[model samples]
Target: MASNDPDREEEAAAAGEDEDTGAQVAPIVTLSEVAVTTGEEEEDALLDLKAKLYRFDKEGNQWKERGTGSVKLLKHRETGKVRLLMRQVKTLKICANHLVLPSVKIQEHAGNDKSCVWHASDFADGELKEEMFCIRFGSVENCKKFMETVEGIAESSEKNEEKESKDASDAAGLLDKLSVHESKTEKAPEEVPAAAVKADDETEK
Candidate 1:
């Protein structure tokens, strides 16, 4: 049986209106938030300039522009080595999807009073295996920032490796110490039993 209570009906109506309002407003709020976040991300990406990527042409003996993109560092999971990954903005038939330059070597050179040049070498098996790639930034500040970022990652990786090596050495030393202590304990038990046997023999005589 339904009771026709005026207050209860008014409360029910109010709840329904709230639900309707929420349903109408939720999409607008979500869309606005998403728009703001996406805008910020795009702006941040733009801050990383889309510089021209060039590689040395051995045949022509000149640096040739391959594509335009931002350079990124990729770390190998198994080997824990940092590799240079060039993400191309425009797709090129000659270039791979992402140009993977493994074991990259970076060198910075001063171009002029205003600009700077960066040279990246991709090596394999201790030899220069690929053409030397060059990056020319418009200003010294940009070039320095790029170089510092790369150098920071390399230094971090080296520190991590050193820490792991030191930890392993410490663990080995601890195990060796435990083994020596155990051996001493076992020898102590044998010595005590031998002395007890000698004392008993002397008492019997």
Candidate 2:
């Protein structure tokens, strides 16, 4: 025989409610926030622009569509090394090898001023070569914006590299100067004996 106590039934129901509340999940994270975080962690991009990628056909002397992609100007947070990332839309493929912001150059087409050419070296062939890529904007203003953004990133990257090189050179120069000073200090006693001998000879004369 079991006694069905009202208080006991209420207590069991309350425990079940408590368990359900405890199992309730936290709110889901948004995709945009995740993307921003990933971008910051991976590249710390200075410039990110959407553009249609084209490869210049040397034989036909015309530009062909590679895909629509985003060009990102990124810098290594630790090394300060600049790199360009061409990431295709709806694809996991990314072109990031031997990419330098300084190597990126933009120019207007000879026949059509509205059409712009974005050129950069693709060293995936393991050789020194220039690979041309064209990006056309809907309006002249958009074209200018793209050009200015790329150019600005390139110029800033060049300056940063130059400054780093100069700093390294200066540090090397300082080390060399310190080494020379140490060597001179170590030889000072040898020179003193020579000077003393010369003084003694002069005194005897």
Once model 2 is optimally superposed onto the true structure by TM-score, how far is the C-alpha of residue 12 displaced, in angstroms?
A: 44
Q: Alpha-carbon error at 117 in model 2, in Å?
A: 1.6
Q: After best superposition, candidate 2 residue 88: deviation in angstroms?
A: 3.0
Per-prediction TM-score? 0.48, 0.59
> lDDT for each of the candidates?
0.56, 0.70
Report the error of model 1 at residue 26, Å: 38
Best by lDDT: 2
Off by over 4 Å in 2: 1-41, 95-98, 111-114, 123-129, 187-205
- Against the true structure, candidate 2 reaches a TM-score of 0.59
Instruction: Please list the residue runs of candidate 1 whose C-alpha ends up more than 4 Å from where it truly belongs after superposition.
Output: 1-48, 57-62, 74-83, 92-105, 110-131, 187-205
Tens digit of lDDT per residue, candidate 1, span 1-205? 8769999999998998777444344454443334323112221221254455667788999878866665554555555555554556665222212212323345664444332334444442244444666666666687777666666666776687788899999999999999999988774433457889999999999
